[model samples]
Target: MAAPEQTPAQYVPIGGDREISDRIEAYLAKRDGVDKLLKISRYASKIIIASSLFESQPLNSKLKSFESSVGVTRKALRLGKFLQSFNALKKSSELKSKRDFMASIASGGEGLYYFVEQFVWLSKAGLIDGKHSSRFSKIGAWCEFVGYVGSISVKWMDLSEIGEEKERLRSESDENVRELKMMELEEKEMMKRLSIVQDWADWLMAFADVRDGKGPLTSPLLLSSAGLLSALISAHKIWVSCKA
Candidate 1:
């Protein structure tokens, strides 16, 4: 019997004169499998994926602290790159989209991180599972993964670029014929902006959903008290239109 033929990995093209783009392309060019594909974009190795984040580890002078959740920083380029690549994969034919390769495994709504983690995790580590050795190694691996990836995965985005929607209206009084007529005419426009604002809110909730412990409102954004559903409501309630 003959061995299965090697399918060549497609070149991942990233544009920009920046060094990070060059670095990402270089990582993609050498890698062949899903495991290699995913790790290339992680901002830090010790990022919490499998376990409940609320189950916190003691503050360690020895081991590194946990990484921030998404939206915690604009510099989380590894995650940004992984998501960006997922978008790019949609447009190309020659490159095997990660979805194609990972179709057998499921997301379980874990998104891109789950796929990357399956690739980066070690099978041998399973041998030590539930043992003291495993705990030590897990901590060490987190440190090493973050240290190894370095600045290649870091990129910054302006907050405005991250789905900003300017507020429009409902603040206008329904008084008289003309004001009411204008509000009626502009209701759809107001709804559209409201929808955009809601999308950001929905995303925040999803981020909260995937991680354990605090709700999105209380977590990265440090919004207090409000839980996910309430945050969703408040996102809509707070955005009354300013008259131009």
Candidate 2:
């Protein structure tokens, strides 16, 4: 599903002397962990109220239909006075999942084993879709994920292996476009057509930034993904010539 072009939605600002909103904000402000937020907002009403501190929707929808038929406490309604439950709607699902996924990955060192497990768990749990799901279908996504985490992506897998996988992913993405295009033949569909390519490009650039054991202050040297196999062959070509 496509994201709304509108700016991210947020809960209305808490006014002075408002207690429920203030309590929820104080409670949620301490919850830097999305897992906790997911649990708290598992229901649409809580999701609507607790999420005012940030821009997001509810979580793990199948956790219960309580998600849609959220019983708003009169207390909550009185506090916000303009909140929408947005229940039973899939419109916010994509946003919900991505927000959860990014927050999960922000740890910066979850390692490969945990990373794969995290991807599988998040996807199987239906916590993510759209780019998140499509990325799971790409080798580049895993490769890029290691960049965000630590050096869990050891230098052992060959470029040839990754290249072959990439070729297969490109073909799959093209097939997806062909399948989707028939359903949108009348629309301009600019984003629908370009999103896959853009996603792959973003993944590749992100994955190539191997810090090469340098400190945070150092320029990154693309770490070879495989011992003596060199994922850096292509990256090095551009690195040696670029003035950036």
Candidate 3:
């Protein structure tokens, strides 16, 4: 249910006088950190651009430009990100004789999304013809939507299993052991719930993309809010890992 790259990192304390700066540096050392920050900026810009506060035409233009610039930069950073999904798929396959259906779907869809995204970026960056951008963008959005659906399903299954395990733990007569195990399961349940929420947030944005920003649910305010929420969740997870 967790992200493939969310494996726990060893805890290492920052010992310098500039502890805050050191922590910031440490966080930015991870790729996800930068991506999440940019995502926040991008979505924030979207919200501001659509807000009544930015009624000035020139200001709105600048806001739109900033959002577009941040978006393109994020895409640039993800140039080879599809390989991460491929690696996830490979790792999953190696772990079991029978393939996990939802996992495979998630990984495959994610890989395809990122692969198509490269062209989208290239077009946006002016390195390629922009004519195909719309088509590629639509395809990428659908792929992302598919991936999120698979991810949500996988997480739901994990949450169910965790619930079952917790139910079994109820019969454990050892007070201390039962409490500790229950606590662990509670933490895991909380994490899975967070992951599902994040996935749904992203799925909303993907829905907007596929709809070409047409529907009422795909309104700028809604999509921007969803994108910002998803970015914050991602950032929180990455920051936690940095401190682990």
Candidate 4:
């Protein structure tokens, strides 16, 4: 899942009466916009492939091929994505002075995940031996799962802090001040909740990967649904950030 911006939410303009082409251009101007759309399409294809509607072998084969193509393209787009996690790790480490274990787990694990993912992408792209793909994928999935665990823990802690701050602000005598602060906290809370949900969704997919699609819980339908959910949530965050 794409990380939501750490900045506080603020009002922003969006979707004016501009031409559809212009709106699309504005959206694609953001680096992650195309990737998010591809993610949605990739997972949507999986859902179709898993569904009973595509029972024919030929149709299913085509759908799977399309999904594979989209998945590979998405990976290509994330060629340097590890830098994001690395930068976050550096900043978080500086701020926490090495005492925040969860922070390290979140950013460090994600960095490792993305770093390892490059080889997996290469395997998929036929630049490396296909035999290493499974091992690389499993390692990446486990790292992603660990990263999400830390990420969710950190977000929950932030929500707890926000809740406490809101409690303190509730007693403020100034009506305007209270309302403004409350609104800000509410927005923050909403974003945090959305992020948590997205992480959980992504975590499910990671778990499926780690399991190598073994159990009923990791069925194609479940995995595809989780991926689609995470993709949509990511798209939502990116669109809102673009508007901002």
Candidate 5:
């Protein structure tokens, strides 16, 4: 059998300085995003191993406490990155033009999809199944939280007033009225998205509450780690029981 040729990833040009691929790369390389995500995945795997040892000697208590701290830190880190990236994308001049904005959106959406896929892989390897692990539950919760925020952000971005004005420019008899209306609608949408982004950013910061050491009764990170560990332990127990 002949080997099939692999297609290269398509790159879209943005402006004179930035290409769509460059922006996507930059976004992924963001310290507040990728670094934290990797750390979270690493810790999540550790939690699974730790959970398995909980039945043994002195390791159980220490692992339990450490798991909580790791979980909180992960949640805080994710929330911070999500807010920063969302705001940057929303405010970019490149995103102001409909065509340019859509390109950026596609880049961002694809990047997030890739991140989530990696997350699922890590979960499976770490034995963080939702049915048996708290860590998996936490991961699922964080996913839902991110989804909610992303949905609202998209809705705000696709404001109808702005869309209508863009359409109006094509056929209106008077150029002056058309231009004025476009400006007004654009400004309104910008202000609305800006306000919503600000509020969401604030909420994420509160969720993390790095300084206070408190936020939700249990941090998402902690719950996720604990869940992952529990799942691994349960699976291990099941295997031992079957062998016995």
Candidate 6:
């Protein structure tokens, strides 16, 4: 007799908006206990959406048929649009002041963490492709966000260092006057970079919290991820300069 055919695992019925809202509430209650709850929440929401999209009979049937029939470029574009909608609120600019900017970047940091957690959940559940999944998108987005933040942090540190060097040069009244002038120029450039960094930082914070129904500005994961990117970039730059 032929071996019995293996059956696909049955999909569990997930609670809809009500369950999602309740989970969000529970997560918020323990927000302070964790370092980057906002970012984590963002990822969690994405995973939930992706899973729901995959499990629902109507949606999954449509998606599977579309995936098989569509070209790779078309599929990628569709995926990008799907992901972009989740963060559409981030493009707003109603709050532009420095204070508001900082608060916003902080929130973005938290959102990064939430997204990471969601990636993990989805991967474990096998709702998406493990090798080419939403996690990769999350990683890319995080790296880009953090890379900008890291650049700013490095510029700030570099400016501080250059400022001290310029002061020391000013105190010296020796034949190194020409060297002092060069140092001054270097300090000016460093300061300019720092200014740009600060402005970018403000923008990033605000971007994370922009939502239609929500208030502007918030994330710890975003902050940490950004910090990590900044550190890596700063280190890489320093290493390259040293090698040169």
Q: Highest TM-score among the candidates is held by which one?
A: 4
Model 5 per-residue lDDT tens digits across residues 1-244: 9889999989975574465455555545554444444444545656554446447545655555565555545543453344443454455436556544553453354335334434544453464563444444444445434543554455555666567667867687898987887787776676556545543543353234322436563455454454444334433333322321
Using lDDT as the measure, the top candidate is 3
| Candidate 4 per-residue lDDT over residues 1-244, each given as its tens digit | 9997698888664546455556577679866889999999999989998876767999889888999999888888888899998888877775553336788789988998988889999998899999999999999999999999998888889899899999999899999999999999999899889999999999888888888889767988888998999889888887766542
Score each candidate by Cα lDDT.
0.34, 0.35, 0.88, 0.87, 0.49, 0.45
Q: Write the per-residue lDDT of candidate 1 for residues 28-126, one digit (tens) a residue.
A: 443222222232222222323222333545532112322322212212223334454445435443436443323212121222442343333322234
- Model 1 has an lDDT value of 0.34
lDDT of 3 by residue, 78-163 (tens): 88999999889876765452237788778989999999999999998888999999999999999999998888988898998999
As a whole number from 0 to 100, the lDDT of residue 52 in candidate 3 is: 55
Q: Which parts of model 4 have CA positions greater than 4 angstroms off?
A: 1-15, 19-24, 94-99
Which model, 2 or 6, shows the larger lDDT? 6
Q: How much is 70 displaced in model 6, in angstroms?
A: 22
- For every model shown, what is its TM-score relative to the native structure? 0.20, 0.17, 0.86, 0.87, 0.26, 0.28
Q: What stretches of model 5 exceed 4 Å from their correct place?
A: 1-30, 33-54, 76-79, 88-244
Off by over 4 Å in 2: 1-183, 186-189, 210-244
Candidate 4, pairs of clashing residues: none
Least well predicted 10-residue stretch by lDDT in candidate 2: 220-229
Ranking by TM-score: 4, 3, 6, 5, 1, 2
Per-prediction count of colliding residue pairs? Answer: 3, 1, 1, 0, 7, 28
Clashing residue pairs found in predicted model 3: 11-244
Error of 3 at 157 (Å): 0.5
Q: Candidate 2: RMSD over Cα atoms?
A: 23.1
| Sequence-dependent TM-score of model 1 | 0.20
